[model samples]
Target: MTTTTTFDELPSLVGTDLGYTEYVTVTQDRVNLFAEAANDGQWIHTDPERAASGPFGGAIAHGFLTLSLTIPFWTELLEVEGVTAKVNYGLDKVRFINPVRVGSRIRMTATIASVEEVKGGLQINVDQTVEIEGQERPALISRGIHRFYA
Candidate 1:
């Protein structure tokens, strides 16, 4: 985990890797809830029996579900003090390089790519990659942007 004493200390983080988070298991219940909420109940994601006979050999998490995990992953990797508000600005580039299977353990690696002064605060760009244990490639690779204010 990476900790910052204050908001101003964020800018000094440029080009530094913020470190990784502990593995979190991808659960069926979580995937099901995400499917229901996103209205994306694809059989490959929600149907265990059917998916068991299909390509991946079993049910897999929705791509969006993996994307959504970024929130908690980032939170676990970064801690800032003296910040009144933090907003998710957007993502620059996102790629789903691998399918996340249920029961898989995944964690995030965060790197501070850049930091710049914005209207009300600092706009920070983080390069994030979600990797599955023992996997050569990451399940998700993205550039996330966030703004922080005092």
Candidate 2:
């Protein structure tokens, strides 16, 4: 279940399973764009002709591209009200469990693992898993930490 809560209710959100986001297809064009923007034009991520013979069989997305989708997926999972700013503090224990091939779809399921009071704000820790569509093993897992300033 997606959650929308106020800053005042943040404390109660700890340990809640915030549910999954809509599936997003990983496309070759998207991967190529990311590679161009990141200056990481690795054949495995940008050159489909070359990558077709590589291990993954075709170009795959950069791990960081998948990681960057965390924010959009998080938005689908939760929305915090009455916050002037919500900051992405940092991530913890990030792991790319599987390579996301172009044309594959992925989604995320998240849990609010912990919450703590911080100066002028609240610190929230969320455990997130990005699951590949129709696959048993997830594509990625990480702890996303954020600060919501009142």
Candidate 3:
């Protein structure tokens, strides 16, 4: 479920665990498109035949591709109401902990680590973990920062 919050509600959200998004299956097509768009057609991410013999047993999504999915997955967790704009300020930290092979499913669990009011907006820090289906370790973990303009 998605949680919508207003500027006034920002303070109360500090240290809140927003929870996980719905699972998204990572397909070969998706990996190929990301590789193409990124101009990073590494064999392990595109050529399935070659990749099948390589490490991980099959084509795996690029680390950056997995990181990029964070945005879409984040929207499923929370939305800030009455914001003129919400910008991805940057990520404080990001680590690809596991390979997300094609045909795997992933979802994100988001937690609000911190929130502070700025001049015209709020600086929100979120800790996100992208988990591969049935996996003990998460595919990726990141600390994402956002600026929400009122």
- Residue 45 lDDT in model 3? 97
Per-candidate TM-scores read 0.96, 0.97, 0.97
lDDT of each residue in 1-150, candidate 2, tens digit only: 568899999999889999889999999889988898999999999888999999999888999999999989998999999999999999999999999989999999999999999999999999999999988899999999999999
Q: What would the per-residue lDDT of candidate 3 be over residues 50-99, giving only the tens digit for each residue?
A: 99999799999999999999999988999999889999889978999999
Would you list the rank order by lDDT, best first? 2, 3, 1
Shift of residue 88 alpha carbon in model 3, Å = 0.9
Each candidate's lDDT (Cα)?
Answer: 0.90, 0.94, 0.94
- Candidate 1 stretches greater than 4 Å from native: none
Give the least accurate 10-residue stretch of model 3, judged by summed lDDT.
2-11
Error of 1 at 106 (Å): 0.7
As a TM-score, model 1 comes out at 0.96
> On TM-score, who's better, 1 or 3?
3
lDDT tens digits, residues 38-147, model 1?
Answer: 99999999999999999999999998899889998889878878888999999989999999998899999999999999987888999999999989989999999999
Pairs in steric clash, model 2: none
Ten-residue stretch with the least lDDT total in model 2: 1-10
